[model samples]
Structure formats: structure tokens, C-alpha cells
Target: MISINDLTFLIGSRALYDEANWHIKPGDRVGLIGANGTGKSTLLKIIVGEYAPTSGTVSMSKDLKIGYLNQDLLSYDSHLPILNVAMEAFERQNQLQKEIDELLKQMETDYSDDILQKLSNKQEEFSALDGYNIEYKTNEVLAGLGFSTEDQLRPLNTFSGGWRMRVMLAKILLQDPDILLLDEPTNHMDLPSIKWLETYLQSFEGAIVIVSHDRYFLDKIVNRIVESRKGKLTSYAGNYSFYLEEKALRSEIQRGEFKNQQAKIKQEERLIERFKAKASKAKMAQSRIKALDKLERVEDVDDDNPTVNFSFKFTKTSGRHVVRLENVTKSYPNVDILDNAEATIEKGDKIALIGANGKGKSTLLRIIAGTETFKGKVETGHNVTTTFFAQHQLESLHLDNSILEELQAFAPKHSDTELRSLLGCFLFTGDDVFKKIRVLSGGEKSRVALAKSLTTDSNFLILDEPTNHLDIQSVNILIQALQQYEGTFISVSHDRYFLDSVANKIWFIEEEKIKEYPGTYAEFEVWNSKRVIPPSKSIPVVPTKKEEKKPVNTNADNKQQLKKLNQDLSKLESLIEELEKAIKEKEAEMADPEIFNNQDKLSLINNAYISDKSALEKAQQDWETLAEEIMNLEA
Candidate 1:
């Protein structure tokens, strides 16, 4: 569907892509992968026309439709119900409906034959556009992406960034584009949502390019692997696991060639040096020098995976019993998290907490950290010093402090040199250690927070969504760190690969109670999937076929509400744009070192950010108030 040839993209004097070529045919499921800053997301933007190649062109059919989902897409929000926002995907249908509505209003005043004819024409066009099924398609896509019927009626502005991202994805999916470009699409998804998306994409008819660090996801959804390495797109003909094997074979061959080539080159140099001084052999020496200069040297293989190179040490050891929770109960405004839930962590236990969203995985982690309120008995084992790393803690880092300084402040027990060595293992090199936390990307900040977590002499750790924004390389580094850790830890994550690599036990919450399986995530999945099957009987998944979607009818009330939405759509769009812009500005100001230093300025900036979001929330509430008349308006 798309052809990329001899593409070269430059950033300043650096080449992000150099004469890279790729062809995406129909139904190509490509997994684009590389280290952070290797331009995976940038390449997606280039395909979507948001960015242009510095040299070369991306050509495709004129009628090609592309759907792109990225972090920036989350900036879009509206006070309209998510259902209506998703309905906006039917652009031509909406226009036709509006014209038909205008014609109907005209007929109400004067039932002219001309008005009647125009109304009939518009209605015919709307039907031809499949406008009758717009609501059905939107609702189906939203539900598949893990939204409830009630959630579809709630305003887009009321959802958090992660949820709003799903709404955006629903809109994109409803568009039914010829190709989809998803960047880290699973970063915000839970296990169930990820599985749903995987199944959906497996049935998709069009091409898809996914950039994600979730290897299990890639293995499930993709048939081809494309590595963005050395400023080129190298194609692999199978899933990620296959690519690993193929790449290893290629690396071995390259290493051999590199070694032989280096030896030959050294021999040629030695011969030239010995012969150049003699007048009789001077001419031959020049010819040999020229031949050596013209030789195409082989590039040595670079290690993509970095491991633990620094000594990981803890000053104290915990007792045999790391932690004990008895009769823990916690609840929220609408959902009950725990009802006398009980679980335990023992010395050297590596547990993975996983479930669908709103299952209170993070809440449980907090209760263990002693940072959350609960009505239960939580006992900590003796000599247990703990370190907790959560996404929210990334903001707790001193914005003005350099990474080195932040680690120094947190790890007073370690000397500057020792901390520096530790940071290097986390991929923070010489100058990178001096970068202010304010300027670090999400992945970079995650690394710094993780580095700080290791700085503690604590033997017990709790990490929440530690792999959320990290690239595969960063995730690998984290895996190495976690594997090398001698203490007990409980990590909350949706990454199955990460869990399988580090977790010895799996913990999940169900029916407001904690459940445990004493095995790796892969083992747990196998057991869970077959939990209901009899031991003698086997699951017969024969002749598997996907469920077909058919057009469904919408109720009359929703039709009226959808029509009425046209009048307020533009106003809501404008308001959302302003709110998003204000939020970004306030956030940037809050990150300013000067503002961070001045307590008053920091408070004012933080307040402004909160106020901007609150205003957006108020706008959403207004939409909710309208929703009885807008969403699910049927009496």
C-alpha cells in the first residue's frame, strides 16, 4: 500500500535515516523496533505526512487512507460525549445529514416540491455512505477497546489521558483506514485490552505498522519484523522471536567476516610499511596502499542488549518473611478494591501483579508501601528497608537537579564515583548524567527514577508500571537490573515478556480478593486459559473463524441527539483546543527550574495546571448534564 525508497531524514547534522527503503504491501503486519531516539515514531509521522523526509520521498496511492495513533493524538478532547466524538469520524455522512436536516427545516416552513426533492437526494446519499450504521461501528470499536456503554456516553474531556487515548484509537479505527501506524499503543493498555487489540488486528484486512516495546504483543500480532538500526530499515521475515535467531546468525557471520577483514588489512598495512622505504619496491607499495584504501571494510556487530555491569549491593537482609497482609479492605467512590483480601511476600520472592484496569493493582502496591490508606493488618518483616518506584514518583525528582545530583541526593551512602558507575549501567553516559530532569524524556526520566531506586540499601522494592514508557533496550536494561537484584520485589506491569523474565510468582486480583499462582507469567497464562477444562479433555479450537460484524440500528432518541450535536460541535472543539493549550503551557512552566526554586511560583504554576484540568472537567460535567438529552437519551 505504501512505498518508501531511498529515504534519508536528517536532524541537524545527524542522520536519523540514510537511504532506507521499505515497501508495505497489503495486509503486512510489521513490527518496527529500535532503541529510543532511533526515530521509530518519527518514521510513523513521516508516513502520515506530519513530517517530511530531508531527502527522498514516501509515495502511495492518491486514495490511500492512513490512521496514526501516537502520544500527541491524546491532545484532542471535547465536551461532547465520546460516542458523538467518535461519530465525527463519518465526515461525509455528517455533511450529508446536515444538508438533509436543513432541507427538512425548509420543508417545515414551506413544503415545496424542490425542498422535498433535495431532502430525498440527501437522504439517499447518506444511506449510500453507510451512515445508518455509524453508531453501530463506533460503539463496537469502543467496546472492543474496553469502554463500557455508559463510558461511551461520558464526555471525552472527563477521561484521563490514557482513556482519552482509547477514544482517539476508537475514532481512528472507525475511520477504517487502509493502513494503521500505532506508536507504543500498548503503553496505556492492560492485559485484557492488549489481548482484544491483538485479536482485532489479527483479523484486520489492511496493513499495520506497530512500534511497541511489548515483545509478547509483537509476537502475537506481527508476521514481519523491521529493525531500525544503523540508520536503515532491515527486514526480518518472521516474528520477534524468529528475528532474534536470524539476527544472531547474521551477527555471527558478520563477526567472522569482520575478524578476517581486520587481519588482512593489518597484514597489508605491515607489508606497505616494510616496502615503502625501499626505492626498488616503492611503486608496488603505492599500488598496495591504494588497493587497501579501496577495500570495503566490514562493520563490526554492535551489542543491542546492555546488561548489569555495576556491582549491585544491599547493606541489610530481610527476615524469611518479607511482608504479611491480613484482612486488607479498601474501597473507592464507586468500586470496592479489596474485601478482606490477603497475600504474602517472602524473602527472595519476585511477584508480578497483573489484571484489567481498575482492579486495584496499584492500590495494593501502595498499601504494601505504607503510603495508601486502608483498613487492614499489614505487617512488615524485620530488617526490611523498602524502596518504591511508581510513575508518579518521576515527578518527585528535583526538576532543577542534574541526574547525577538527583542520584547523589537519594543515595547518600554511595560515593559520587560509585553512583556514576551505577548510572552508566542504566545507559546514562558521561554528559548524560549532567542533564536536568526537566529536559529528560519520559523514558529517560524513568531510567533516572529506576537508578535512584537502586541507590537505596533497601532489600524490598515495589515498582508500578516500570516499563510503561521505556523502549525495548531500556526495558532490557531494567530486566537485567531486576534479575540482578538480590532482594524481594513486587512489580505491577502489563508487559508479559517482562513479567515472564523476572517474576517467579504471579498475583492477580479477582472479585475483590487477591489470588496467587506460584509460577512465571507464561506458566500462569497456560494454566489460566485451561482453568475451566477437564484434565482429560482438551480445548478444540478447530477451524477458528472471526466473528463477523453486521450493521445494527440506532434508536430514534440517539439520532435526534446526534443531530442536535452538530450545533455545538465547533464550540466544543474550540474550547477543548484552548484548554489543552493552556494545560501544556502550565505544565511547561511548572517544569521551569526558576519556578521550581521559588515555592510561590511553583505553587502558582501547579495550581494553574490543576485549574486548567478542572475547567476541562467542569466542561465535561456540563456535557454529562446534557447527556440525558444527548447520550442514551431514550426515555
Candidate 2:
């Protein structure tokens, strides 16, 4: 167990954490959540003892062991194969065994008391650490993380940055420290690998604190949520979904408290004002004034929402068929990644590609974008303009160029005013637009790349891990824009919530094959659940007590109710459209040039504008409610 008491950290004069307290029990599984730069990573470092806190104490049991995994990795030598390097985690165990072997040989040769005693103690320590099963367990973890048998001999240098991180993760898991401090452990992992990690962590005999933006992963793995905000810490019980609901409830309670305090202060002030105006009640007025002076004001809590935003609107539409691949095969020198994989992309299709790490998801994206070659038929649609955003697309930007120059290069024909306005849409202000590309942070670089992509007229977009460094607000904006887009999109991303919001189809790459499903993400989950379960070929299976008590639904009755609701929504949409058209016509008449010159005409137009806007907003809200009902009915 670890305890963080009165912890405070500062960057120059800015306080990142102030007098915050948090503790991790023996079986705690915590998901750390906060906006960018709120010190989630810093807290992890403090817990791991990598950084000394500016103030306060981090107390832990003596002889405690802790492991930390960072996003950036140091170079791992590839001279030895990947498996050999990963197996180094058991070095101590291996050393103990080697000594044990020598001790046994010496015991047979010379019967010295000291040598005999040493051999016995060495064997005992080795057995205590499960030294006999170290190799098997290490290999198991490596394979679970998606390393092929043949890849075990491949040099560590041959692996890419993502694969190197996977190797690091395997080593950390093999170490099995008393506490695991992971910052974005799922960032580079694919679906299968992520699931494997979740299973491993769920059974791990240690406390874990994970800082990640992946909602699905948190929902599956974490049992508690710790939010770092406004230099303070707030704890919530249960998983990410439970945290969301609990945080909302807490905010509601705080809002009610704030309102009540404000009302009380106002009432007291009114009474004091009336008494002060009368000479007869001057003493009472003085007493009331003193009470008012001593009264404590209620400070409203700050809004915790992050202000990250993105607006990506394409200017054209692609052909009916955007891309098609048949009989695709990809392999490295020692291993085959994809075997006879085939996929297709049609216009207006929001597709999400998923699979385990090293399962050819990225390889397939590269093949489609024509960056990597494959033995396959890749036919791009006619008049198709493709915009490919790779995982490290931000690094591909010219560092020498200023942010403004980078946008200008992408859209040279646009005037300065137009370019500046476009930059503003991506959250770049006046001076930020002038900053050098090399000077910006990773999050800023990602935003720049996104803004650059939006300036083009491409109708076909292929993105790989596009939301890596983005905050939640930016993700929402991007999701909204993609929903409004009229072109084709094929993305490989680990952000489950983003995929659920934008993707309409699921393309799974598994077992060296590609599988496609037509429906929303929730529908895909249901299908996947069924597919993963093996059919019963046994003699018999008795029903559980809980299952026997549950009532089976009548499908016929549900279908009739859904059909009726859909019909009603169709009628409401038509009525709202007619009212919107009438309002638009009335507003256009008041905007005439002669009327604009008259003050009275301007006043009339302004009043009409407000009324029309209010009506439109109300109608939109109603339509949204009906749309949700229709979605539920369809589901």
C-alpha cells in the first residue's frame, strides 16, 4: 500500500497540485482522469518515486516494489532476438538457478558444510519466487501481447516504436511489482492485445493506477476513479461509467448549495437596505450591516470541462466506391502479418478497423494508402482525392516552418485572412498561429495536422490513430464534424467512444483475416459476443437459478410498438421543417437595403431574428429527443 499525503507540486509559480491526498490500498485498481496538463502523469511519477514532490510526504511500506511505464522508450538493443531481451526480466531468477546447479555439482564433489548450507538456501529462495516457471510465464506474456513464435528470434532493433513499447509492457508485467503505475498502457495496443492486458491486470496481485483516455478500457479494468483537477483530487467508486454518473450527481448537489447561499445573501442585503433608509431602525440597520460584513460568500466551483475543439469539414464527395482491396497478403522477413485479407470502402461509409497489435491493421491502412506494397488488387475509385493521416503525421510537418507557414503551404491559394480564420477554428489564436512548428507541444502538433487536412478538398480520408493526443472536447468537436461529413472515412483508432460516435461499420482483422459487419458499434458488440462463445456439443447444460427466474421477451409485441413510434417521429419532422421555412422567408423581408437604413426596420428585424432563433432551437431539441427514441426503437 502507498499513501500520498499533503502532496503539492509546482512548475515555477503555477501550482499543478496543492495539498492533495490519495491512497492506494493493497487491492486497489484506480483509473486516473483529468484534462491535459492537470498532472495525471506527474502523480504517477510521484508514486513511483521518479520525481520528488515539492511538498508533502509519499509514504510506503519498507522494501516495497513499484513499476512505472512511460510513453517514451529508450533504445532497446536488437542484436539479440525480441524474446531473448524480454526474457531478461527473469535475470535474478535465472541467476539463482545457475548458482543452484553449480551448488548441486559442488555438493556431489566436496561435502563442505558452508557449501551445503548455501545450496539449500539458494534453492529455497528460487522456489519462493516461482523460478521454475519463469521462462514459461515470460513466453506466455510475450505471445499474449501478439508476438509470433518466429518473431522471438527477431532482433529487438527490427521492431518499430509501438512494438518496442509492447516489449516494455511485457517486461513490466513479468516483473510483477507490488504496485503497477501505468500511463496510457493501451495507447499503442490493438483490441486483442488490450483485452489480453485487461485479463492479466484483473488477476494481477498488486495495486494499479492507470492514466488513460480510453473509456472502454477503463470501464473494463478499473474499479475506482481518481480525478486530478484544479490542483485537487476527487475520488469516485466503481468504473468509468459509474464515475461519470457520480460526478454529475456531485455537481448537481454543489449547484444547489451555491444557489441557496446566493438567495440567503440577497435576502439579508434587501432587509439591511430597507432598514438603513429609516431613521427609526438605524440601530437594527447597523447590526444587519455588521452581519452582512461577517457573512461568508459561497464560491461557485469551476467548470471542469476541457476546452479542446476541432472542426474538420471536407469540401467534396468521393465516387460511389472509394477503395477496394482483394487477396491482400503482407509479411515481414520472418513472419506473415496478413494472409489473403480483403476489404472494400464505399462513399459515405464511416468504417472502423480493429485487431490485435502486429495483426496487420496498420499494414492494411498503409497498403490502401499506397505507402506500402502488397500482393493484392488495390483499385481506387475514380476522381478520388485521398488524405492519409498516419500515426506520426504530426512529426512529418516541417519543423522549420511557422504554424502559419505550414497552413499556407497546404493551402497556398487561400488569402492571409482566409488562412487565419481557418487556423482560429482549430483553437489557434493570433500569436499561436505565428509560433514555430517545432516549438509547439505534441497536442498542438496534432491539431496543426488536423487543421492542415481540413484545408484540402479530399473526399476520401484514411486516418490511423488520429486522436492520440487530443483532449475530450476536441474529440467531441471532431466527432460532430465527421458525423456531418458527406464523404468516405476509414480509420484505425483505439478511442472506443470516438469510434462508437462516428463509425457505422466495423471491420475486424483477426486470425490473419478480415471480417466486416454492417451496423452501429453496439450491434457489432452483440454479434461479437455470440461469435466468441463456442456452441454446446455436450450432453446437457442445466439452467442457472437467475436465468430460470427471468422472463423471455415477446418479439412480436416489441416490433409493433417500435413501428408505431417511428411513424410518429416522421410526422413531427415534417411539421418542424415547414415552420423553419416560413420563418426564413419572414427574416429575409426585414433584411432589405431600404429597411436596413431605417432604425425601426432594424429593430423589427432584430426582434424577429431572436424569435426565429428561439423557435428553431426549441424545434431542434424536440427533433433530437424524437431521434433518440427512433434510435432505441430501431436497435
Candidate 3:
């Protein structure tokens, strides 16, 4: 539906994209992936005609409708309720409705058949455009995005910045434009809201071009990855994981080519040097010298790997029992914010606290971090070290201090050089390090907060919505870095992919109660699925591939086979649940004290349990095999 041909963009003297050729077909769900400052958002703006390219052309179908969601726009305000804001997408339909209403009113005075016929025709057109379902669709999207029924009637001013973004999303979805250009669409969405978006996008009719940092979302939704690097566009026919794997392979190949070119250039120079020293081989020497001069030197591309590699060396050891909240209760008149809540953060625990907005998720984080006091016990671990990063952590930084100076103040032990190096990882390069903290953008401020957090040698990290304002690549790098750190962390993040990556346990905060689920994201998904449907009906069928092995080919058959394998893998997930149940039952039987007391009974139960456990292990391994196959299919 849209095409970008030989597109070039320049910011001052620096090139953002040069001869970048790309296009979106009618139903293409392409994900624009790149590191921060790589012009993903800029490209989207160019496509939507918000900004003109320095050269080349961006063309689209004459009647193509484009819906572009910029990261941060001017806040919308009106006396109408939130629902009305969404309903604006269907303005044509609304106009038709207004005409019908007027027609009905005039029916008492003018009994003309022609007027009634026109009214009937307009009503039909409106109905065909799904005008009747406008209210229902508006409510569906709002509720899916975590807006309460009462919230639908509330004015836009009543909502926070994040909530305002949700309102924007609802309107965009309602528009159903031909091409959807989303910039960090999931930045403010909670897990459930993100899931809703995933499903919505999956079934979306028109083309989708998204620039998001959520890996899981990209992996699940996007079929293609378009990367912006070194003022060029590179396309990969797969998801985010495939892009990573292929990019690594391409990097290795480039490194090899670069080395070979350097070797050849040196070899030519050596021949020239030898010939210059001898009279007999003067002609050959001059030829070699000319060849060396004529050699077009390869411009080596710098490997832009911005991975934060920092470790916290705790100054003091914390007791086994960290911060403990016993019967902690907080209320504001009629509303019970936190009702008799109890939670604990032990040593070396990585916890993810999540809940809907206005559900006290941040309030609880504050109460635990000792930023706010509660009615009950807020016992701290013995000699415990804690560092809390609230959502507004950037605002907490000293505005007068430069980026480097701010880091130095918070992390006094680090030298100027060390502080600059740390800031560089967060993309604060050259004079950016010298910029005053107050002058930085929202994204820059977020990076500063992250840099400052790493400076502390605290064993426990308490972060609230740390992923906010960060692009997808930054979030993934942060997730990867945090996963390796040996520290107890309690983070409140709306990024589901981030939580899935780093968190080993989930602390779901709902109805003023904390529920702990001990498992990875996949396991949690299985448990959640069971809660929705009956065990018998939930059985997933695993289909075995017809062939023992398949040859590597880029033929249509290969694609079809991959699709079939993915379908089969989806079917086989139910077997995992069955095996899990058996394993649990066996463990329970082996745990019985009476069975342990009798030698014969103990042996029988132990043997049966061990056999069952082994079988379960094999099934789990097979499931992994199927999962990898599905991953390849996606790739």
C-alpha cells in the first residue's frame, strides 16, 4: 500500500538514511527494528508525510488511509467524555446520524416522500459503515486497554499521561486505516492491555508497521523485520529473533571480508616494496604499486552493540528476610487502597509487581521502598541495601548538574572517565555528556535514571516503571543485563516482554492482595489457560512431522511444511499439562510421612515417582523440540 524508494534523510551533516528502499504491501505486518537514534521513528514520519526526505521518494496508493501514532503529541482536551474522543474516528458516520436525526424532526412539518427516502438512504450508508456498533467498539477497545466502565463517561483531563496514550490508541484502532504506523505503541500498556493489542493486531485487516521495543510482541506479531543502520535499510524475512540471528551471521561474514580485504591490501603493498628494492622486477613492482593506489579501500562498519555491562558489588550482606510487610493496610476515606496486604522480598529474588492502573501498584512500591509509610510492619532486612527508582526518577535528578556531574554526585566513587563511559552505554556520547540534565529529552532523562541506578552498589533494586520512555532495543538490553545480575529486584513495569525476560516469579497485585506465581512466562501462560477452560477441553494436540528430516530449500513447500509444524506444535501443548499433573501427584505421594515410614511402601512410591518423573522429563524435552520447530517456522 506504501512505497519508499531510494529515500535519504539528513540531520545537519549526518545522514539518517541514504538510498533506503522499502515498501509495505496491502497486508504486510512489518516491524521496524533498530537501536535508539537509528531513525525508526523518523522513517515512520517520512512515510506518513510528516517530514519530507532529503532526497528520493515516498509514494502510496492514492486513496490509502494512514494512521500515525507519534510517541508524544499535544494532549487532547474537550468537554465530551472519553468515548466521544474515540467516536471522532467515525466522523462521516456521525454526520450521517445527525442528518437522520434532523430528518426525523422535520417529518412532523414536511411529509415529503423524497425527504424520507433520502433519510433512509443515509441511514443505510451509515449502517454499512458499522456506525451502529461505534459505541460498542469504542467501549470494547477502552475496556480492553484497562479503562473502567465508569471511565468511559469521564473527561479526558481526568486521566494521567499513560491513560491519555491509551485513549489515543483506542481512537487509532477505531479509525481502521489502511496503513497503521505505530511508534512505541506498547510503551505505556500493562500486560493484559498488551495482550489485547497483540490479538487485535494479529487480526488487523490492513498493513501494520510498528516500531516497538517489546521483543515478545514483535516475535509474536511481526512477520518481517526492517532494520535501520548506518543510513541504510536492511530487510529480513522473519521476526525479531530471526533478525538477531541473521544479523549476527552477517556481522561474522562482514568481519571475515574486512580481514581478507586488509590482508590483500597489505600483500599488494609488500609486492610493491619488493619490486621497488630490485632493478630486475621494476615493471612488475610499478604495476603492483599502481594496483595498490587504485585499490578501493573497504569502509568497515562499526559494530553498534550497546549492551549495558555493569555489576553491583553489595557493600553489606542482607539477612534472609528482606523487607516484610505484615497486615499492611492503607486507605483514603471510602477507598481501600491496600487492604491487609502482606508481601516479602527475600535475598536474591527477582519479582515483578503488576496490576491495573489506579490499583495501587505504584503506591505499594512506594510503601515497600519506605518512600511512604503504612499502618503495619515495614521491616527491613538486617543491614539491607535498597535503591528505589520511581517513575519520576528523572525529575528527581538535580537539574543544574550536567549528565556527567549528576552521575558523579550520585556515584561519587566513579571517576569522570568512568562516569562518561557509563553514560556512553546509554547513548550519551560526545557533548551529550556535558548537556545539563534539565535540557535532556524525556528519553534522555530515562537513560540518565538507568545510568544512575547502575552506579549504586546496592543488593536490592526497587524500580517503578523503569522501562517507560525507553525504546524496544534499550528495554531488551536492560532485560538481558538485569537477568545476569545477582541481586534481589522488585520492579514495576508495564513492559510484559521485559517482565517475561528477567522475572522468575510474578507478584500479581489485584484487589489489594498479592498473589505469587512461581514459574516462567510460558508456565504462567499454561496455568492461566487452565483457569479459562476445562482441563479436558484444554488438551493440546501435538502433530508429528511426516518426514524424518527436510532439506534446506526456499521453495513454497518448505513454507507450507513449516506452517504445518507450527500448527502441530500448538496442538501438542496439552500433553505438557498432563505430564505436569502426573509429576506433581508423584511428588505428593513420595512426600507422605506414612509411606516413608514403611520400607516396602517407600520403595514402591519412590520407584514409581522416579519413573514418572523421567517420563515427564522426556515429554518436557520433546515439548522444547516442538517449541524450537515453531520458532523456526516463525523465522
Candidate 4:
């Protein structure tokens, strides 16, 4: 529950919000919608107390707890395991457990009434905080976000930026705040995760305010829409579809009013010009002029939103069969992502890869694109020029290069003017083209990647999660461009609307097998809904027999091992803390103007900072390992 009253935010000469007022009640599901630069995200930050409004007040309940999922990936200790990262959400619970453990250890030596009382109190506090169920809840949330069981134990640094964002989302969800402020929450999630999120939010007790470009997701989760435009906010009561219809009707009425107002102003101007010269009518002319001056001008209505206009051109046409795979199999140590999967893609075919996360959809696409090694017969037709866009393509960008320079590398022959025009279509205009890739937001980086992918001529396109950070208008424009493409493409996307619009064929991957269906996404959904699909039988099962236990060590021996491990863990933690503090101090020093002004000093500090961060990460990993070993010994 929150209330924003007469809020006004300004940046330089530009006004993002002018006297905007809105109220969010309990259980309200509100979707924030606007063009890319209309301050939708900025408004969310204001509500979350990250940004202060230039004028007016934002009031919330005193007991309200807000969970915010930031658009940018926050800095983290890379060496920490993801499970520990998620556990950070339960601060009080973790503290209680730590106290309980320490108290128990103290009681083992003291055997005093005071220690026993403290231990009893801590145990009661732990139970009240649901400390025992923390592991179960953490595992459930992580799995729902597409993390494998083994992945929870892996260090955070091993995952890509997108996956790291999912880790952040898991932390926020586990926090269970009274309100949720999510910005493009589904950008990094696969279809299965998105579906799970939708279901989870449906029963959420608190209010939610989300800024998303996923239309289907908005339709499924939001019960209200808030549109920001012209430094003002307007509220509509309904889902996204209902909001669209209502907005269209409002725009139509506004257009009529604007036209009528323009006509009246023109008539008055003509009358004033004609009568002002005559002495007899001068008074009347002055009256009309004053009236015109006092009247408020009507704002012109935009018929349609701005969109990108670009087309893909192929250097040469491909043969009848664009791609073919025979008995393709991709396997890891103990898991088979794809087992003898077979499929044939004809020329001009637009296929959509759909399945649960980690079910070989991307793997299949990689095999076809010749990026991954597989045990199978894979062949591309004659004259087929393939271009592949990986899911983490944005991260692969040269951060030191300007956006214009990045595109120029792909198209060396194109003049600056032509490249600038191309960048304009992707919403990078004027000085934006000169910005280094490192300063760009996730969505902006994604656009640069998409623009670069279109530079070279290719007949077969293989894209993974291409629409992850795209806005609705941009996605529509991209869909229109792909519709007119003459080449074949295979894209893996979780956007149901995008698939429905672009996909002419469906490749469903399940249980390490690919099932091909010849139809649109709607048709595929219909057939899937009608049929009673059987459970997957390919999942490997372990033997039910229990293993023979080894002889247990004596209590004294176990206690000694535990004591050594605890000492190691304590030392490692102390080292990690010192490294973190040093790194922070170095970073603060580097941020000073004098430090950056000196080239030699700046370089020295930068190197030291990097070294310190690396040491900190290693120390964190060592600390985690020692702590786990201690836990095992104590158990």
C-alpha cells in the first residue's frame, strides 16, 4: 500500500513527472507502461526510495517491506555459492541459527544454567523464524528460476550475467516483502520459469508494481495499467488487452478535440488579422486576441508509436533443405540433453524452439549452427550462410568500443552517415552512437547486438532468446522485419505472442527428443492441449538399495576435526573480510578526481583494486568450503 501525491521529478530542463498522483492498494497488480524514455523505471525507483522526487511526497505504510528487482545486475562476491547468496535473504533466520550453534558449542564446555537458557531461547527463536525450512524454500525458488540442483553449489562467477540476474530475482522472491517492484523480471527467465513466476504471483498477498515489455506476461499478471506520457500518469482498470482498447478509444476522442481546437484557433487568427487594421474593429480584434492568448492549446495526438525499420538481406538463396540432422546426441557427464534427436528444416522455414528450461532447445540450435560438437550427422544445404546469436551475446560485446565503432567493424564498407542511419532505427541517435558499450544498459546492449547481427548477409539465422530485453514496440517492428525475410531462421524464445506471430513451425523438445509439428504456435498449443501427453520415460533412476555404512569415528576424533575446521573457517572469514574492506577503500580512492587525473597513480590503484578483488573472491570460496566441512563434521 503506497500513495504518491503531487509528485514532480525533473532532470535538467526535462520533466519526467509533473504533478503525478497515484495510489496502490493491497493486492493491487499494476503494470507500468510507457515508451522507452518516459521515466517508467525512474518512477519505480522513486517509490522504492532510491530516487528523490523534485517536488511532492511519496507516503507508504510504516510496516511496509518492499522488494525491488533492479534492471542492472548488482555487484556480488563471485566466489560465493548461489545457495549462500539466496540464503542472504533470510538475515534474521541465519543470525538465529548462528547464535544457536554458538550457544550449543558453549554449553558443551560450560554446562552452566545461563548457557543452557541462552541455547533454549535461540532454539525457540530459530523455530519461530522457520529456520529449518530455509533449505527447502531456497531449493524450491532456485529450481523454479531454472537452476539445477548442482548449479546451486557452483560459484556465482561461473554463470553468465543473465543467470546472475536470476539469482538476484530468487533472493528477492525469497525475501517475501510486502510489496514487489520488478523491472522486466522475466527478461532472463525461460518459458518454464516465466510460467512458474506467473503462478506464484497470482496467489501473492501483497501489492505488485511491474514494468515489463512482455505483453502476455502483463496480461496474465496485471489487473490494472498505468501509462506515463507527457510528464503525466493515467490509470486504467483492466488487463493489457483492455488497456489497449481503452487507450485507443481515448486517443480517438483526443484527436477529435485537437482538430476542433486547431480549427477554432485558425478562425480566430484570421479574424484578428483582418479586423486589426480597421479602427472600428480594433477593439473587437484586441478582445479576440486576448481570448486566444488565454485559451489552453490542445496537444497533438500520436497515431502510432515509433518503431524500427530494417530488413535482412541474404547474399544468396539456400537449397531446398536448409538444415538436416540425423541421430544427433549431446551429453554431459551423467545427463543427456539431446539423445538421438532428428529433424529436417526446409528452406524458408521459420521454426520456434519451445520446451522447459535445460531441455536441449538451445543445444539443438547450437548443433544446427555448427557451434557445438555433437555425435550425429548434421548438414547444411548449399549456399547457406548462417548467423548465430547466442543468449549471452550482449556480454560478448567489446566494452571499450563505441557503439558506432562496434557496428563499423561488422560493416567496414558502410560510411558513417549510413551507419548512423542504421543505428537510429535501433533507437540510438546522435551522441548515443558515440557511447562506449560499457555504459549502456542491458536493453541498450541487447539492441546493439541485434543491430550488429543484421549487418552481415546470411540465409539462415539461429537466435537464442533474442527477445529477452526488447520492448513491445521494438519486438513488433522486429517481427514485421522477420516476416518479410526471405531466408530460414530458427529462434528460441519464451514470448508466446512472438512465437504466435513469427513461427510457422514448432520444434518441441522433451525428454531429450525433438517432436516436430507443422503449424503455427496456436495450432501447436491446441493439439498439445487436446492430447493426453505421457510422462517422460527417459529420466534415469538410481538404485533404491542403500549403501553399506563405514565405521563411525569416535566422538573425540570427530570433535577434534570439527574444532580444526572451525578454526580454519574463522581465519578464512577474517581474511575475506579484510580483503573486502581493502577493495572498497581502493575503489573509493579510485573514484576521487585527483586519482583519475594522474595516469600513473590511476593505473597503480586500478591494478591493486583488481588484485584485491581477485583475492577477496578466492578467500570467499575458501571460507565457504571450510564452513561446509565444519557443518558436515558437526552433523
Q: Which one is best on lDDT?
A: 1
Instruction: Score every model by TM-score.
Output: 0.81, 0.74, 0.80, 0.77
Where in model 2 is the C-alpha error above 4 Å?
72-92, 101-113, 263-313, 326-342, 404-434, 510-514, 532-635
Q: State the lDDT at 259 in candidate 4.
A: 98
> Per-residue lDDT for 512 in model 3?
64
Better of 1 and 3 by lDDT: 1
RMSD to truth, every model: 16.6, 24.0, 17.7, 16.4
Predicted candidate 1 versus true structure: per-residue lDDT over 1-635, tens digit per residue:
89999999999999999999999999999999988778999999999889999998899999999988999988896999999998888899989867866775676688888886776677667657866457767777887788876898999999999999988888887888899999988878889899989998898889999999999999998999999987999999999999999999999999999999999999999999999999999999999999998999899999887666655678889999999999999999977989998888999999999988878999999999999999989999999999999988988999999999998888787888888877776678899899999999877898899889877788999999988777787778789888988999999998999999999999998868899999999999998874432111112111112223337545664564456653454455566678889988876775564553344675577656655665675455444434433443444
Global Cα lDDT for candidate 2: 0.77
- Between candidates 1 and 4, name the one with more favorable lDDT: 1
Which residue pairs overlap in candidate 2's backbone? 78-156, 78-157, 308-474
Q: Arrange candidates by TM-score, highest first: which order?
A: 1, 3, 4, 2
Model 4, CA-based lDDT: 0.82
lDDT of 2 at 165: 85
Question: Ten consecutive residues with minimal summed lDDT in candidate 4?
Answer: 538-547
Q: lDDT by residue for model 2 over 381-458, one digit each (tens)?
A: 877899898747887899999999998888776666776765665667688898999998877898889867766668
Question: Model 3, 1-635: lDDT tens per residue?
Answer: 77789998999999999889997888888889887888999998888778999999998778989888875553676667888887888889989877877886787698798886886687668657866557767877898898866788998878777788888888999998988999888877777888889999999989899998888888888989998888888999889889889889888888888889999988878778777878999988988877778878776757566666555455787889888988998877655777788888788788888766666778888898888867987888897888888757777889999998888888877677777766777778899998998888877888899879877878888988888767765676578668877778888887777887888887876556767788666667777654422111112234354454556666576677777766665555666677678767756764564552334674576556555544555556556766665565566
